[model samples]
Target: MKIIAALVTASINKPVSTTIGLLILFMLSAMTVVAEQLPPPSATTEYSKEGADTCLQCHDQDSKFPVLAIFNSPHGNKNTKHGPFSSAGLQCETCHGAAAAHTVKRLRKGQVRAAMISFKTKDVISNDEKNQLCLACHQATTTRHWLGSVHQSNDLACTDCHQIHISDDPILNKAQQLEQCGQCHTKEKVANHSVFSHPLTSGQMGCTDCHSPHDANNNQLLVSDSVNETCYQCHAEKRGPFLWEHEPVTDNCLNCHRPHGSNQAALLTQRAPYLCQNCHNSDGHPSFSYGSDDAQGQQASAFLLGRSCANCHAKIHGSNHPSGYKFQR
Candidate 1:
């Protein structure tokens, strides 16, 4: 009886010890699994240019983006035509740089860089760098005056006014360069599209008609810095030392003309006859009786075609004859 009891106790102890060992092994296996599933540490380093070159294998000659076009331009021929790219080591990689990190983030679902290039801030280049970039390869003639222009003072970038690609659209077309200027020149746009404006609608004239892009020593982009000189470029007939000269014409064009675009004929700021009446009296002239905005003053203003003060005083700026008071040319 004693031996049978010893045997039963030994058997029970063996199974109990095995169960305890198995439970310990199960807990340790679960802890190992949890540790393996945790995320990796954050990245602190940047990517290198060599790593970036790998992309050219697929990106070069890509139909989606033809970087080769820019290479064909003056920007790309800096080595011979210009000297900046070779001297400064400013190649295709300089502007774009290593895109590996950005590409990796997109592919592996990792963190992205804060500055993603876009239409508004595509190049990531600084404003001061713009002049340097252009001057590096191109001649300094066209953009030299830009350094002290109103646009520079206001932090306006070169890209803001000019399109690098130069689109074929009306606004981007080279011949219609004024359309680009018109986009931001709200007053010009309004005056040009106004009901009584000049042939601005047909694109017969542009901003460059009266203004120069480069080497205007006086008005930055104007053909002539002096207001009178600029005006005389086209209205050479009016630029005269006649018997009498209009004070506004002698002083400045802005005194009477808007230049950009105006609701009045020939880009005048105010309506006809009234514009004349500002200086001319109302004794017996047809304009005095008919061109005023006042109900009783002038119904003739509405009846006139061009709404031009020239309708009456054809020789507006000056008169040569002894009795040219009416400016009848």
Candidate 2:
């Protein structure tokens, strides 16, 4: 263990040894190397006699793995029976499993330690097994739908986004949460940087505003039953059962708007007249262009050249106006 620490410390102090330190870290992370290797499962089933006190002796301040900050976190509360300082008294071992075999007086040079549940995906611990321990306590509330969630189905452990040992977990913050999620959803990250997008990148809004990351029941991870309903949470004015209704407006918001990001204004899938032209160009709407040089002119069709169908049909979404049969309030 000292040998591993020396390598890590050298990497920190001497910039040239970074590669060597990284290699050592990678090997040590596997938990199969001699320096960090744990014993067989049979040998490590018992909890330490001193419980958390034994582990804290080495992990205290001035040690490589300092955990004093955990005292400020929920898991470290001594008052609660479920916490580390509980009366029944299984502190560090409560989540880390038994450490009795690991605290064997002193670790001699090149000797392997007892097996420990490190809660790391790439280590000897299986991701599901590591998550099961957390699920034992956090199976309710927001995590109730975690069984078949996208993050769960993708084999992501709770620790992947959560920092349980620390006082401040980045996932709790709206802006930092986007960065945590952006680690995997790279496409969304790129879209968020585009000219126009939801206020997520600016911290004014959040991914959880419309999505339930732990929910598998909702379509596209939406907070509501559908995309339009999700939009109506903020744009409630557009959700009217007006005197005149546009069929497409009641259908799906995505039919015209790109919910994430787009180059067009108002997140439209395409420009206005061309967008309205997608459906309206065929039925009594002029098929040919109303240009300057055209001799075969339909003078009334020139109104469509104003760059938007909404210019004439002001009530694009719907119209409460009595003279709004064509939605031109």
lDDT against the true structure, per candidate, is: 0.58, 0.77
- Among these predicted structures, which one has the highest TM-score? 2
Candidate 2 residue lDDT tens string, 1-329 = 67667666666755666767677676766555654554443337788897777888888878877888888887888886566566764778777877788888788899888768777665556677677778877777678888878878889888888887778888888878679888988888777887778888888887888888877466588888888889999999999989899988999998898887888888888877788878785567654345554434645545545436776787889999989988888
Best by lDDT: 2
- For model 2, give the 10-residue run with minimal summed lDDT: 34-43
- Residue 15 Cα positional deviation in candidate 2, in Å, after optimal superposition: 80
Task: Give the alpha carbon lDDT tens digit for every residue of 1-329 in model 1.
Answer: 45445445555747787756655666686688789885322121243454424434444665454344454544455564433234555354333433445434344356555342222444454565554555444556666666666666666665676544222334334446656776677676667666565455577766666666534666446777687787788778878888977777888878888765666666777777777778878566556442345545445344363445576667778899777766766
Model 2 Cα shift for residue 114 (angstroms): 2.2
Question: Which pairs clash inside model 2?
Answer: 39-115
